[model samples]
Target: MLFLVAALLLLGVAMGSVAHAPLPVSLVAAAVIGVWLVVFTVRERHSRRHSS
Candidate 1:
């Protein structure tokens, strides 16, 4: 999870620098991170419920 966030952030920065389009790259990265976080949280909750 942390790795994914870091990778996306780095990719965003690299893209922004190369493309000179920080807004789009940053928005994409933010959306990806948000989706990832939501999925992770949901999966964690499901696993905990099943385990218990």
Candidate 2:
């Protein structure tokens, strides 16, 4: 799906940026990515449940 692709692209960009960033910056970016993934998962599950 488009949303999934967009999420993956964003994740890739974040990871790439993190690779060149300082340790503290990398950590914060990692945390934000983690939270984004969690939110995406929850939304996907909720949408599926309701659609079914």
Candidate 3:
């Protein structure tokens, strides 16, 4: 999740610098990463509660 977020940020910057166009791909990538992070965090919290 962290990797995805970092990658998306980097890609967005690169695209912005090189192409100077709107970064649709980077926006989608960031959204995907954000969703994955939220879902994983929720699942981890639930698992910890049950295990304890």
Candidate whose lDDT is highest: 2
Candidate lDDT (C-alpha), each: 0.87, 0.92, 0.85
- lDDT for residue 41 in candidate 2, whole number 0-100: 100
What candidate 3 gets wrong by more than 4 Å, as runs, is 1-22
Give the Å shift of residue 26 in candidate 2: 0.1
Worst 10 residues of 1 by lDDT: 14-23
RMSD of each: 5.9, 4.9, 6.5
Worst 10 residues of 2 by lDDT: 24-33
Candidate 1: C-alpha RMSD to true structure equals 5.9
lDDT of 1 at 28: 88
Candidate 1, position 18, lDDT: 52
Candidate 1 segments exceeding 4 Å error = 1-21
Rank by TM-score, highest first.
2, 1, 3
**Local accuracy of candidate 2 as per-residue lDDT tens digits, 1-52:** 9999999999899778878899998888779989999999999999999999
The alpha-carbon lDDT assigned to residue 7 of candidate 2 equals: 100
Question: What TM-score, computed on C-alpha atoms, does each candidate reach?
Answer: 0.60, 0.64, 0.58
Residue 39, candidate 1: Cα error in Å is 0.3
Per-residue lDDT of candidate 1, residues 1-52 (tens digit):
9999999999898866757656787788779989999999999999999999
- Per-residue lDDT tens digits for candidate 3, residues 1-52, read 9999999999898767656545796677679989999999999999999999
Question: Which structure is stronger by TM-score: 1 or 3?
Answer: 1
